[model samples]
Target: MKQRPFARLRAPRSLAAMATAGVMALALTACGGTTKDSASNSGSGDAGSGASASANPNAPIKEGLKIAFLPKQINNPYSTIVDKSGIDAAKEYKGEAKEVGPSDASASSQVSYINTLIQQRQDAILVAANDPNAVCGPLKQARSRGIKVIAYDSDTNPDCRDIFINQASSEEVGRSQVKLLSELMDGKGEFAVLSATANATNQNTWIKFMQEELKKPEYSGMKLVKIAYGDDDDQKSFQQTQGLLQAYPNLKGIIAPTTVGIAAAARYISGSKYKGKVVVTGLGTPNQMRQFIKDGTVTKFQLWNPKDLGYLSSYAAAALASGQITGAQGETLKAGRLGERTIGANGEIVLGPPFTFEKSNIDEFDF
Candidate 1:
């Protein structure tokens, strides 16, 4: 009497045999189900498959995409760090990053790279432009072709590029350098500025801002005697600094906004008879200006970490590529470990304020 539930309803001899076969056939049919619904229910499903694939443009665009980071020059340490940080950022996204730039910071050379990136169909170009508007035409072409253009360290025209990654605000850099120079000179002296090429975007901006700030009553005693261009060349900067000394015999301080100019001036002052009489300061790096600082030729200088600039630039580029940001003014972005910063009106992201370095803390930073 311990019969199975369906076993009690035994079929007629032939019908029972047919029912058993029918049940077996149904079981097999269920196991070998080929319905669209079944296919969707299995491992290889169609649930949102088409929509998901089509919704993400960057997912496909990012695969095997290449980004180029073109600096003003390949030889300079500052640009070298830019190149390195970009490569590191690309590695995280499984992308390709390469460096292409002139060895001498020529505008024509940078233009060539812009053209090359366009021809290669690069995904994005992050450049530290040699001259503003010089590479605009090619960068505009890149934009038309769906390639994103970003400027880091220095910027091109806003209409030509998607974003500019500024190491710090132009005014902050200018004021910080002026303050450093004033501190080094004890708040009163005739000082000359050794800037980069006259057309250089960053150097000119900072110099102008510094000149305006020095006119304030708090800095009225400090006289900015002259603004000279060194073209960012070592020999030229050295000669320019020396020329400033000759041109202004009473010059008590020198502010070289260009790293090359600043370091060259420091070296020149250190090797000359005016070593202790004149203090050299500006945007030189810790490694390059360390000896001069130790020797007392450069008592103080101001700069944001160059590596941080590179790191932030790469992160911003990634954000743009991933469609996380559009480089719009007032948009805020987190530059890696450095906190959030709102994009400026110029489509630039300012890294933050610059810090002055003197004997007390110059030794703590390596570059």
Candidate 2:
């Protein structure tokens, strides 16, 4: 139950807001709108700032507890898989859940949806934040109104959520990318990271570690010249990859730590003159990267199972709603099928570690 000194959750702090969403107030009429009865929200009491921060292992997951999944982008393949898994997991505990979000992965796009969820009075709202500060105010309002906020995949500002369901240790995810790229590039070359949104919490945290890792003497030969943001768009990321290659003709590698960015980078490199000359590696799904591996466009890449990330997050939401844990260090969470997991400092529950995929074994699994 002791907190590990190896890692500390990023301290809660205010940063400049990325953008603000216009707020609209609406009143729901049962005749044309959803009410509490119709929506099936059925949990309470421990969601406010004043709720008791204690764990009760025997508490039952409340029946009809309403939870919602708000991914960075509803249409994104990676977010789609993660959110669907959360929805299915909610059903296992008799909790009602629905997915809602903007089609674009933008900082302000998700704000209106969070406000809608608040108006609907859902029991919990699970989010994969696009920008930590942009969504902070709305999340605070949700929590103030007694809605449990659980952030998964990408985190919000630390103070905005009840607990964070981290897919893997942030530092490990970052350093691993540099390590993978080093081995692929023979520990010496010019490399640049093709990351997600510029304001993305998870992506930035991992990038920080990657920069730190590069300071090691073993990696003295490699240089990180730039960090480009794709905003998680397919076309833009493809263009970004092309631009990176043309701009840095001598660049030997690209690390894209986002699923969309990685796949897009691979797609561009596969058909271009850089196919065999540049090494592309980062986090991605097997289905998305399998073809690239087969064609030798990418020698190696890494990712944790996104489905497992969702399932674990859903169960953790259930635990918080059921009053089993209170987002405190040393508290234990019981995730169905995945078994029990302990909470660490700053209410973080890391799903596990990342896995590397290569030609010889890429065909063995699918997500």
Best by TM-score: 2
Tell me the RMSD of model 1 versus the true structure: 23.4
lDDT of 2 by residue, 16-105 (tens): 111112221123222323423422332233344314555787898999988888888776878877777777788899998878888788
> What local distance difference test score does each model get?
0.70, 0.82
Cα deviation of 207 in candidate 2 (Å)? 0.4
Cα lDDT tens digits for candidate 1, 1-367: 1112121112233211111101110010112212123222211221211111222223322446578888877767666654675666667667777777776766666887677666666667898877887988877766655566789888887777878888888888888788777767889989999987777788878988898888878887899889998877899999998899999999999888878888999889998999999988888677778888887888777777665676677767766666556676666665545556677886778776676667766655554
The clash numbers for all candidates, in the given order, read 0, 0
TM-score of each: 0.80, 0.88
Best by lDDT: 2
Q: Return the TM-score for candidate 1, rounded to 2 decimals.
A: 0.80
TM-score of 2: 0.88
lDDT (Cα, 0-100) at 166 in candidate 2: 98
